[model samples]
Target chain A: MPAGEICIIVPCYNEQENIKNVIDDIIDNTPSKEKWTVLVVNDCSIDSTGFEANSTGKADVLDLPCNLGIGGAVQAGLKYAARYNYDYAVKFDGDGQHLAKNIETFIQELKSDKADVVVGSRFCTKHNGFKSTFMRQVGIKYFQWLIKLLTGKTFTDSTSGFRAYNKKALKFMSKHYPAFDYPEPEEIILLNKNKFRIMEIPCEMRKRQGGVSCLSSNRAVYYMIKVSFAILMAAARKPEE
Target chain B: MSAIQIISITGSLFFILAIIQAIRLKRLKEAYALLWLITGFIFLVISCWQGAIDIIADLFGIVYAPAILFLFMLVSAIIVLFQYSIILSKQNDQIKNLTQELALLKNKAQGCSKDLPNKES
Candidate 1:
């Protein structure tokens, strides 16, 4: 079998301070022989994120007309991956949190033919990295328990944005993934409902280098309720063939 | 006629006229307008025949006659609102698809334009 084409989708919103380093890290760490291309999806940032990404000359930049939130931005990248017929797609956050070195593990897991989707879990191993704030950790644990209750599978990091998908997984998600607000936890339930094999590997993550997180402490309660309802809705929804 | 009857008839007439006027101005699509037009016609019938609510409520074994009308209005509002939510969801999906497609096509165009300089060189 031939080596497959891979598209690393970096969804950014006002990450002008960190987009360049993120893109460069991805480019530098990518295997030399692998056919890899970085695609920076600028989610209608008010800053010069789009311009910064364009000047990098190493990745393609897609400027959305309006702010589509993280879910919509990632979905846009998946749609592009589907349109271009990429064999694999990886979602790497542009906030300087996710490390590029871990992408190799995702690719290896995909090549191993064990899982259709690979999620990078920070809590899977005892690593001394910048785990999110205490409040966020509590919220993450809540989702972790919720997913376990719903899917009968344990996920240490239910809200980790670092993930990779094969063509089969990406195609289904491109069309059916929730386009509303945050989709990380809901998407895990969606994939499980559709019988997609999901595997998690340990990966290190850093704190955000710039820009405010969309989920502030004040919005945490709302985020939990919205995402929990969405997860339940996804569980009850019939799988689209 | 009772004062309530006169008020009901006037209200129903205005409602029906507003529906027609909306259709004329192309603000309401005929398909959706049909539901509201039917509702207005029912209201006019009930208003004109003072005993209509009494008879219908009796048939349904409802003790209070006016409560039946309120129930009818509530059910109608719910159905109309539910239909609107469905339409809103479909349009939202379309808008999202269009936005993504536009961005992807523009990226492709930029890629082609970037290659032109290399080709010339």
Candidate 2:
């Protein structure tokens, strides 16, 4: 692999405590021994996330002027990768739920040309069962059903943020990515409509190392309603060629 | 002086106020704000002259006026989203082209430096 073949994008918002550890893990665990770059997109964090990410020296940091939510942060990362001609780009959470060890599987799947976008699914393999509140499980199931209905494809984890994209997928997503909370489901539909291939790879998820889970019960309910309506609206619109 | 007339007049006034505010604030470029403006104006006109709106609705054979309003709102939302997507696509293309050009220039510069002889010698 030549220099800059693969780029890992980590979107951080006030995850100052875990950002350094996450980047260190990625630097240590990246496979292929190939030249890969990490891009830490700081979404206007009030904490030291931006400063810490820059201090680590393991990744390049792009600090957004204003907080644009997770969707906007991830989209900014994809746009950066796409603009720079990166062969592949992966989105890793800054809160540390995503394991760096599993990233190799995603890259290998992309290299095999199996899919343009490979999602890391906790449900795909029995290695580790997803540990979350029962309410979250219910919400996930509902979103999965909605994704299948809207996109005509069954996705085990529609809301997983650990995903990899080839150049083509990155290009498409950089343009039409959603701009709200829990945007993965709507993004899947948008990708499907654009005729990009998508696949799921099994991976384990851990609880956040520090800080609280951003999704409260109230927020989860609101997310469910908002995302459902957004997906319905997106489906009604014409698909982009 | 009927209820419909009062509603129409009020809607019209609100519509004008929104337009003037949008123009003053320079928010006309935002599609969401533009949609609101258009919706407001449509309501204003329709309310001010219910007879004309009824005639138009009858021509379309739409019995309930509120149903038509709901349909218009849905359509407006879809259009705004579609327009946003188009703008995003164009921006993506421009950025890609610019990056490619920069990469090419960097390669040329590297080649030129490599061909030069060592001045230290």
Per-model clash counts, in order, read: 0, 1
Tens digits of per-residue lDDT for model 1 on A1-241?
Answer: 1123788999999999999999989988988767777889999999999999999887778899888889889999998888778888999999999999999889999988899999999899897476578888888899999999999999998888999999999999999878878899999999998999999999989988888788788898999999999999898998878
Candidate 2: residue pairs that collide: B8-B47
Off by over 4 Å in 1: A1-4, B57-64, B115-121
Model 2, A140-188: lDDT tens digits are 8898888888877889888899999998999888777785567888888
* Residue B63 error, candidate 1, Å: 5.1
**Candidate 1's residue-wise lDDT over B1-121, tens digit each?**
9999999999999999999999999999998888788889999999999798999999999999999889989988888888899989888888888888888888877776552111111
**Model 1 TM-score (2 dp):** 0.92
Q: In order, what lDDT does every prediction score? A: 0.88, 0.78
